[model samples]
Target chain A: MMDTEHLGTHISKQFNADLENLREEVLAMGGIVEEQITLALDAFTNNDSDIADKVIANEKMVNAKEMKIDEACTKVLAKRQPAAGDLRLIVTILKTITDLERMGDEAEKVARMAKAIANKEMAVANVKLHYGALLHLGNHVKKMLHDALDAFARMDVESAVNVAKLDNQADEEYNAISRQLITYMMEEPRRISEVLDFMWSARALERIGDHANNICEYVVYLVQGEDVRHKSWDEMQRLAKDE
Target chain B: MMDTEHLGTHISKQFNADLENLREEVLAMGGIVEEQITLALDAFTNNDSDIADKVIANEKMVNAKEMKIDEACTKVLAKRQPAAGDLRLIVTILKTITDLERMGDEAEKVARMAKAIANKEMAVANVKLHYGALLHLGNHVKKMLHDALDAFARMDVESAVNVAKLDNQADEEYNAISRQLITYMMEEPRRISEVLDFMWSARALERIGDHANNICEYVVYLVQGEDVRHKSWDEMQRLAKDE
Candidate 1:
């Protein structure tokens, strides 16, 4: 039984309001997760072990938040047995928390890489890349995450679609950077270890971007009651147009 | 309104039976996905374009099966509105199908890699070593999937735990293969493209193994009704002991 004293609302209204709180909770968790990614990438690019430590420490916070949200969802289901649209939305939330948590996991991987390379600076400084593409991709991904959350908040299908479209550019950047890193490794085998860490970070960021896109797709499905997840990008684009 | 005459069972009994049907459907889907992985890995290791084409073709079947299972889960939720243990089991089924579908996607990635490198084998053959560890890992992962699915069927926590334990060795094999491939790339710059494809397939296999471990953990959670997913392996081992 939910307490009705917050607004002195009816039980039915309170259940409705609790669902709203769940959304707010998810968004708050998303905010912390977004910051974790920034802190991680900053730590990674600068080789700052202190920032990396912060990211690692904050991981527990993200995990705890996910558990709290999941419990809230299960409580709602067991108590209310929400039907149809509400059920779909709650299930979508359930799915997205894992993605958000996974994004944190990916960021933690980058942070761990940062921590590992913190004391090994000279090795990394020796490897030359083309035009700072990894940095560019990392920066673009953080913004993509920001917008994906915003789109989710408003259930903005168009905005989510646009963010998903940026994935192609991110893919191109990942490929270009990977090729340059390979060339670097080929030329200076001594720098292989250092370059490999950077490659993993790039791959992690790219996956984070993919997960962000996945969250937005879930939002579209939540709003439209259509499972757009199983389709291709072209099909998603068509679906977005109808929205 | 579920059809009660399917088995001529009472409504309550029919709901119970439908849950069984959901499990069987998931297992049936899991079987095909397992076959897809075996076929894809066989294609990758042999560089058989014909077999790779078969794996790629089989992907649609996997996707369709996931959709069908998803629909079934939704039907159960709407009709039965199962609570407690039954609800948790249905939810677990929902989560694992996404994982299984993603496993199929990873296999498709390996298949595509096989297709890309099928005609261009000279570079790959030029740079190889280390007792076929990658092949061994792929084969073991298929076995891990077999046991994990078996654990799900019987609610056998011990079997699930064993499969999860095997992930550490799989991780080691994947890393060793990756390092060897990197060494190959350094030795022969012309082989970078081919080696990169092999590396992607190895990473995909590693990820597939990870998803397998995740499914096992879900089995543990299903039986114990505890969320042990966010814990470390040591933490999980400790938690399991407490259980």
Candidate 2:
């Protein structure tokens, strides 16, 4: 029989626990995205097409997990009719899952670019193409994603703000690598396809960094009810610290 | 004064109207994005950086509408404690506003690229770069976005599926333009930056098309409660029509 009265204002322990389970599911899916980014980056730097294939293969896992979490959150919303903070948590989960799914899509794009470049001469021309910088940028983006998920798990606004600050580094790294690669493309056209592929991979990482930053902003919104997208990094840090 | 009894499950008319208000707000935001895409495309084809500047300026309008709609949705979710279809509508709005905002960002990126290429001699060389193909692809994406929003407003599942199928044309257009531009870059290195700029604009439109497709998928979930992302386009078409 339906426990129709469970939707009342009195908090139910089972519902609260169910909410926690949803957050845990989000964290679990996030861990997989972290793995996808790491493997995809490894494939790029090592020219390991095998790992690239794995990244491609693992994308299905991310999509499946997203569907699962989304269904769980929707069920909770429809059944619980949760208010205030509980409502915020479920809504945030509903929104962030899409962001996380897009991050998976970006990682898959990077992996595909990696596979395309694996046998190319530019794979060996790492120095000529600033491949190390791209790797560094990719690694940094992966770390920010990890920390952002951790922040969400803990509802740690400070860590989330710090993640946004890290995006500046990602942006700088992307610009530096794009300029270097663009110059290379113009100066010497022999490895143009290979160089462009490397640039595309780096660009994908840069976008992933932006997505991670977006996730962090959502964390702030969930915790503080403030939209921080317009705030400067320093302002975001101060907001997190103040509360 | 607050409606104290709104906490109950009687389905208040005011609350229902408020939910309708939220959907109207989303539709309003959708209208702005449609304008942004149209202007951005005009900017690209005409090499009219001034129109591109207008699109950039309009980005703020889209952002403002998104923030307002988001805050309004969160308010309704927290206060009304809406269940079932009302709840789904709010959740979908929460998720889709982000997608619309990202579409606005992509339009802004295209506009910026247009401005960068406007005064260049290569702007006139768009004919050589398959700019018409990009324009056609972008127009298709805009139409899909328009139809997707219309489908969402009406909760029309069949139209949403049709919007997803249109993504195929966008993908083909993107590939055709990319392949043609890559050949041009290889054959003549003089206008490499211009050609690359064109490619980036086309790529941004393609991503916008994907975002539009994402919006349509959310509409299906809102209406049918079915997660259709995993389904093949053919399957999605069959499912939408079957229901």
Candidate 3:
């Protein structure tokens, strides 16, 4: 009986180690997802189909990584019967994979938009009003995604909350950009459809920011064991402030 | 030993029953979500705040139901260790909840837009092209969501594929509506912001259709255990055609 007990403990330790490795794998996948988004955006802004094609080619990697991570999660879930924190971690991996996969889809959309505009003459004249703002918003999104992943790695709720705050700034910038784009479209009716397509690309980037915010929410849940969703932005700010 | 064996069987049976109940609950939630979308469109078309208010109130119910379903899923997952088909069902519930919650958010957005336009004078020229196409698109969205949920509950993959096919029609209508709204904004620059706001409401409705398509995709997965996501519309159609 004592030998059996010792073997059981050893198996549990092995399982725990596998779970930690799975977590690292998921973070690696997240990093690739964020890079894909940034690359897809750059391809769009520069009108480079080669870069866009690269983004499309990389989606197979994303899909493959997602499946591998999912398999790891299910294996851990089935064999370990992880309770409490470990269970939550596995569940978060599963949820994050879905978000990451959708982000990949958004990136593909950006690439497709870029491909459509590849041969067209540059319409830089109308995009000037909000170029700085859009770039700022894009950088903010990159930071949010970066910091959120870092926070998840370190289990730092404070960093996660900070990432969530940046999402608001991104939102404001998106609104300003959209308003300016509408004005641009009105001024140049001939370019209406093309500009609208670009607006859709911007919207996709803004949505990626929202998904980053969602990842931060999951991080907060992981740390606090509480559901912070459905709360107002002001309330979330206050809570983060208290933290 | 006999007693322990009996207890195990009893637990398994109870767990299966709970899983079925959870699936039913999700379907019921889907029904309520679809209704909110339909009613919000009605409120927008007829300038009816009562229906808008009802949708807003129903959103609370949807939220509460989501929590209940989530709780049930957690309990089963923790205690039951469900495998194979049962495991797939639980994952489906989790994914479906996210879609349903998003649908609720879209409904709330539509209601808010309706309320904003409720007190205002209707458009001066009655925008014949905008409202006509939007009304038809809205009805199509309602039908698509209804059919998707039906396919989900019945595990009818063919029906789900059919519902998915309708998404293209909705997208076409959405594009037509957006062009009309843009034309209006161009004609009346002063009303640009308001027109843009109304356009977003229509956009949200279009997104609801997209989510319905996503649910149908999930149904296909449930039935065939295949991941058809990220495939081209033509490819998906081909697969369905072969069936």
Q: Fnat for model 3?
A: 0.15
Per-model TM-score versus the true fold: 0.93, 0.92, 0.90
The alpha-carbon lDDT assigned to residue B150 of candidate 2 equals 93
Candidate 2's docking class is medium
Candidate 1, residues B11-47: lDDT per residue as tens digits? 7798988999999998998899899988887886677
Per-residue lDDT tens digits for candidate 3, residues A28-73, read 9889988888888778667789999999999988988887787677
Instruction: Please report the candidate that would top DockQ against the real structure.
Output: 2
Classified by CAPRI criteria, candidate 3 counts as acceptable
* Model 1 DockQ class: acceptable
DockQ of 3: 0.38
Worst 10 residues of 3 chain A by lDDT: A1-10
Off by over 4 Å in 3: A1-7, A237-243, B1-8, B122-128, B233-243
Q: Compare the candidates by lDDT and give the number of the best one.
A: 2
- A1-243 per-residue lDDT for model 2 (tens digits): 455645455548778789989989999999899899999988987888999999999999999999999888878887777778887788788777887888899999999988888755443454434767888998999998998898898899999998998999899999888888777777666567777787888899998898888889889988998888766898998898899
Whichever of 1 and 2 has more lDDT, that candidate is: 2
RMSD over all Cα atoms, model 3: 3.1
For all candidates in order, the CA lDDT equals 0.82, 0.84, 0.77
Which residue segments of model 1 deviate by more than 4 Å?
A: A1-9, A126-131, B1-9, B126-131, B238-243
